[model samples]
Target: MLSNDWAIEARGLVKRFDGFTAVDGVDLSVPQGAIYGILGPNGAGKTTTLRMLQGIIDPDSGVRRILGADRPHDVAHRIGYLPEERGLYPTMKTYEAIAFMGALRGLPLAEGRRRGKAMMEEHGLSYAIDRQIRQLSKGMAQQVQILGTLVHNPDLVIFDEPFSGLDALNQGKLEKMIRALAAGGTTVIFSTHVIAHAERLCDEVAIIAGGRVPFAGPVDVARDRIPAQVRLETRHADGPWRAALPPDARHEGALWSFPLPDTGVEPLLRALIEGEAGILSLSIERAGLHDAFVAIAGEAAARALGQPTQEEAA
Candidate 1:
């Protein structure tokens, strides 16, 4: 039985557009206050999943529970969503836009304005609060949108490519804010093609391909799927005994690869000593989440969506 304490739960969720399936069967569970991440290339159905979770679009099949409530049915008040595409009234003042979003989430107009001003000051937007969104820089505009997303203080927050358009400094700032939100007991489900940000910010992650999850778990568990391989260079090129070892060693040219069971250097060290192959250089190689994503999901997924293994839009 799944705990009622979970912020988001889905069982075999499915979504379709006309005759085509946009999101295939998917099972996801997000614990309360987790910084969960959905990673995929373009058209992987991440946005569709978020839309369903937020009740913007109903699912064609399966189950979805977000923020302790069934979506597209009841309780739109407990969720905050930041879409992949930016949307802000060009003529609206930054503070007004944010407060308006808060009001939509059920906060009173006066309280929403107070919170909006506080967030603006907290995020270094105090100077731009009165300015029209059209006059702000792209980075500042993005910040305004983020403030709007959080103004309601929803229990569940969904961010689709939150870092789409921003400088390095702004991206870093957003990352910090995301971490802070999770720490403050907000269940944050964010989708990104950027692998580094996911690796850094997420407690758990789901990697989607072809609109389905192929990998979902902790980062270390995902990393464990790929074995470690080391490349060793010998001092001599044409030494005798180019034969293979019982441990399955391969040699090409002067380069030798003695696949160790893991990162332990002792076995490889002993093998080199026994082989009488003079060692030139030895380096330990561990596969990163990016390599695992490519190896598991294949090159097509990588080609279709060229994003960092953790952070795509960023």
Candidate 2:
């Protein structure tokens, strides 16, 4: 694995399309061997930021460093990029397609072919290696492209919605491969609108909204940014304890959710006991990253589009 150090850095990054800013002033830092997740709703500039980082698009203003290189082009051969949209030559065989992509990044033809073959086997596409891209299943085709992205063994890898068209089985495989990449010292930055994927795989995450970052940090740290709200089930449904909760607390059926200002599991328990709320079952329903993302991005969307937030819409 890569040594524990900074692998990617960006500061005051800005990208505009005509008068519309796709990415506003933003800062990002990803550490070596880290599976950093970039999360946001659609049109929130996640792809724009990633494109700038990959040198597919230049920022209007801002600086980016990849693997100690000031310019992404300087380290182009050392990084692999998988855009949200895909490309494949329908006439080419899977092996041929992968080899061509690797070769474009300067890998020797022989090495690319060898690595491509091995990857096909590893990803369960060995039987389809000789088949033309047009003949393979959509899942098979996607795997072929994914394998192509990794054939050259890049030190830094970027994937946009890597799990977009995957089913549960292939999604599991991709998750395993991502972990393996980090284990082997690759710095992975992937963007996805799915919160569960990032919660399960990312060591650190950035939640973006309206082309701006609202929260960025380790998963546990990001959890802290949202208040702790829990559900408690008491033995006595009609207990007087309901009267003890603050007026702001919510009651749904027999479950009570008290929104604590901070994450204090012990004090929450103590407060329940002090209130004489017979705790038959107490489940901490901490606000998920999705909830937090919606809280931040939804508000921005409200202002940007002059529309109600999802909650307000509901």
Candidate 3:
């Protein structure tokens, strides 16, 4: 037994295939009822790590205790998983598909159907409850799959890239759903390449790149790894106050930007005032997850941050 407080505990998990290491000594701990995120770019081993955790694929090495069990499948009945590669019988009615999924998790078919019908009605999808999967819109199909994943009411929920293929509106709905899940004390673990979603939703996160975890912990902690950034707009760009700026500071026209000084901003503020440097505006912003990822994952990993993934391109 895992003391009931931790939903998952994994240590030094490793998986390799055909001489290529897919996950290299990954470790993760998820507290019960917390919203945790695995963050990385596409092909960064996010899916592999999630698969290992789900026990869908065994790791070449390492151990895991999931939902108080030594093996993942031992507690499978208490977990809900939605994989990135989604599939549902195209001919199956929406409600039947949800009931089928629940049945796989040991829910009785009748109860599953009842819950499925109520859930669809609650989500304002009653019209699609009887429609076949083929006839529903893409977003609607995805929604049905999500409902299926939850039909059994699993305590631990894992969604691998749930936001992929969702438009802005649907994405917002999904975010709201995740929040509701967490609010109701469900332990939610999800993987995503999108930084904004992770930054906004995750209380804790693991940053992965090239099949390796570069940093893992609280989101604020990861962001604090880099000093806060400072942007300054002034009437005059150069003065004795400029000397107070960090050596790496750069300027374009009247705007200067740099990392905040370790000595704090008081000295710089005083210098600007005493030197009569006209400070038009000054702002300090803590480093976001994007900046922290770049700093931790290095240039090679950072290159992928700007490139649109295949899902976005499509």
lDDT of each: 0.80, 0.82, 0.88
Tens digit of per-residue lDDT, candidate 3, span 195-274: 89998999999989988887888999999999988899988867777777788987889988888888898988998888
Q: Can you tell me which runs of candidate 2 are displaced by over 4 Å?
A: 1-5, 237-244, 261-276, 299-314
Best by TM-score: 3
On the 0 to 100 scale, the lDDT of residue 89 in model 3 is: 97
List clash counts for every candidate, in order: 10, 1, 0
For model 1, give the 10-residue run with minimal summed lDDT.
238-247
- Per-residue lDDT for 92-152 in model 1, tens only? 9888889888888888888888888889998877998789989999888888988988988
In angstroms, the error of model 1 at 276 is 4.0
- Sorted by TM-score, highest first, which candidate order results? 3, 2, 1
Pairs that clash in candidate 3: none
Once fitted onto the true fold, the runs of candidate 3 whose alpha carbons sit more than 4 angstroms away are: 1-4, 305-314
At residue 271, give the lDDT of candidate 3.
Answer: 84
Candidate RMSDs in Å, in order, are 3.8, 3.7, 3.3
- Candidate order (lDDT): 3, 2, 1
